[model samples]
Target: MVIEYSGIVVRSVLTDKREKFYDSKGIGCYMFRIDEAEVVDATMHGSAARFINHSCEPNCYSRVIHVEGHKRIVIFALRRILRGEELTYDYKFPIEEPAAKLPCNCGARRCRRFLN
Candidate 1:
């Protein structure tokens, strides 16, 4: 079945010169990496999309869309999702240091032991 995603846009906390930002406990999930030094926090905007969880094998994927010269992150379904299924997407946070490794509880068939 086809599913349309929608949410609010909010400014993200700026991380300097970093390609990725991950928060284990924060509401923020996906960061719109504008460039090497700029990122727009899509989660800070009070959107329900921020609550969407992460999975190694996700049924949805985040795509970057540009509107009015601003970059926005949007989630799109990859396959049919039955009703009551939890919406999920891959965080895809960059794995740079060992400390960046986070345990996964997604329970997908292809669980990547740790989330980057």
Candidate 2:
């Protein structure tokens, strides 16, 4: 499906793992792994797929929904987002291992002291 606003059109995928690859512009892509309240054959392992990245204070948040009988992650805006703003969410919530933490370079004024 396509999520459009202004002239920007983002392609959303309904594949397993909610995989997001870098676009031609180097921006992370967005997709919906579930459709019509049904979860795709996606099982989100604690890999890069779970690392949506973080912000000092993010403008979006991730919500897990149990559709049909599977779990899927959905990102929603926390406030009114401007047209050119980069969408980000807290990745720490999904990672359970200490090794999952990495250095963040988001450059937010209140960025976490460390990338964990």
Tell me each candidate's TM-score.
0.68, 0.48
**Model 1: which ten-residue window has the lowest total lDDT?**
1-10
Q: What would the per-residue lDDT of candidate 2 be over residues 40-104, giving only the tens digit for each residue? A: 22222222333345686788776666569745556678888889777777655333367666667
Name the regions of candidate 2 deviating beyond 4 angstroms: 1-53, 93-101
Off by more than 4 A, model 1:
1-34, 42-44
Which residue pairs in candidate 2 have backbone atoms (N, alpha carbon, C) closer than 3 angstroms, thus clashing?
Answer: none
Local accuracy by lDDT, each model:
0.65, 0.49
lDDT comparing candidate 2 with the true structure: 0.49
Rate residue 36 of model 2 by lDDT.
48
59 Cα displacement, candidate 2 (Å): 0.7
Residue 110 of model 2 has an lDDT of 83
